[model samples]
Target: MIANLLTIAGTDPTGGAGIQADLKTFSALGTYGMSVVTGLVAQNTRGVREIHPVPAAFVAAQLDAVFDDVRVDAVKIGMLGTPDVTRAVAGVLAARRPPYVVLDPVMVAKSGDRLLAADAVRELREVLLPLVDLVTPNLPEAADLLGVPEAVDEDGMREQLADLVRLGPAVLLKGGHLTGPECPDLLAMDATGEPVRLTAPRIPTRNTHGTGCTLSSAIAALRPQRSGWPDAVADAKRYLSGALAAADRLNVGSGHGPVHHFSDWW
Candidate 1:
């Protein structure tokens, strides 16, 4: 059966990030996509001007509407803007227990705008982290979660990953923020020979608005089809690299635009 993917995130009217990017990613990967908007942002590629969060009860209703009929094979969660919203999501996921879940710790935007609330971080750690199959966080996010100085180099990243893996589920430490010619993301799993390193040559581009959203969504899309976590991570990396390489093709916003979701297609 074809996989059905759901994105529980905020709405980005620009279509570069959030629910829009996630649905586009699911379609590009040949999976059926659905979405539940948790918040509405007022801004474009430049930066987030304002965020209007949905009521937690309404968010629960939306999840019930989706799960009542559709059999969600995988779920990609992003940008739960408040502590109440996080708790709502946690309740639903705990009850349904979807087969695969990828949590992208979307604290800050590519434009350096904060998405997740400061006080809500604790809720995300205590409520959501343990429920997910995998949690993907950038260097800054890892530091924020672990309450440490940011990871600067390869050594710093390794040290942070060691502490991050104990937080909850398996961890994927993103190396994009780290200055390097090659972008390497580390996956820390419980299996033997853990901490598999996945690397790709850096694609120089300013149009990387939604790279994180797209990567995590692609991982969720491929999870049901791939053999295991490593394979899914590898495939997601390749997909994201292609999208990044072709990002310039899309002349969307003046600032950081989106990666080409249909790079492999038309």
Candidate 2:
């Protein structure tokens, strides 16, 4: 069956991040993409200037409309900007029980804009983590979730992954920011005998505007149809690496340009 994937996130008019990137990833991977916008962000490759969160009830309404009509093979959740929105999502997912769910705890932007509210962190931890199949967080986001100042090295990443997996669902700790010639991501889960390490040579590019969204969405799109989480993650990494390598082809915004979603097409 063709996978019909959904992304619950904010909007980005620049087509670089948020819902835009998620949808692009799903399509690029041969999945039908659907979306429910939780917030509208005024942003570009340079930075996020402002964000107007959708009302909690309206967010719920969007979820209802989508879930009521479609068979969502997998779901990817990004920037839930408020506590109420987070609760709404958790409740809805609990009711529908989609085949797979990938949560990207998008706390901050590449340009350093705070995408998640400080207070909403508690709600996300309490309500959403248990429901997700996997939680993909970068080093900084893993640190924030674990209440640590930072997760700097391989040891730190493993420690954070162990702590996070206890909250339920597998954890994918992205090491993109860790200093090295290669970027290694750790996938930790009880089902797996040991933590699986995924590594890729660092792609040198300033146009990596929507890497997180792309990676999470790619995994979500692959999960149901792919063999297993580890395999899905590895495939997602390959896709993201290709997109990053081809980013220069798309002459996007002046600052950090977006990874070329349709890189394979051209």
Candidate 3:
């Protein structure tokens, strides 16, 4: 059966990040895509200008509307701008638990703008993190969740992973922010097993706008079809790498542009 994947996130007018990016990823990966908008963002590859959040009650209504009818195989959650919105999403997920849930802790944009508020970070960590199956956070986001400085090296990343998994979900800690030729990602869970490490050579490109959103959504789209989390994450990484490699083929914007979500097809 084709996986029915849902994305709960904000909007990107440029179709490079947030709900737009998530939907594109779902379709590209051979899944039926659905969306529940939490906020409307006015931005492009260059930067974010304005944000208008949907009401918390309305956000719950949207989730209810979907769950009442559709069989959501998996869900990918991104940019919930406020604490109220965060709690709203968590409330529904706790009630009607999906088969798989992937949380992309989208705190900052590729253009260096803040997408999530400071107080909402606490709400995400407390209410949402425990409810999801997996949480994907980059270097700075990991530090923010743990209330510590960003990890500078692999050792630091390993140390932080130990603490993060204690928060009640498996973590995919991305090491792209570290200055190195290779971009490594670690999958850590509470099970008594060694964490899986996957690394790929960093693709040289300025157009990496919606990488976080794309990767997390790809995992959600693939998880229902894959045997386990490790395989799903590995496949998702390969997909993102292809998109990044083909990113330069398209002319999108002046600043950090988007990866080619349909690189394999067109």
Q: Which candidate ranks first by TM-score, i.e. highest?
A: 3
Over 65-170, each residue of candidate 1 has an lDDT whose tens digit, in order, gives 9999999999999999999999999999999999999999999998899999999999999899999999999998998898889988878888888888777788
Which ranges in model 3 have alpha carbons more than 4 Å from their true place?
none
Taking the tens digit of each residue's C-alpha lDDT, what string does model 3 give over 164-209?
9999999999999988899999998674567899998899999999
Q: By lDDT, who's the top model here?
A: 3
TM-score of each: 0.98, 0.98, 0.99
* lDDT measured at residue 226 in model 3 versus the true structure, 0 to 100: 98
Find the 10 residues in a row with the least total lDDT in model 1: 188-197
lDDT of 2 by residue, 28-47 (tens): 99999999999999998899
Residue 206, model 3: Cα distance from true site in angstroms: 0.3
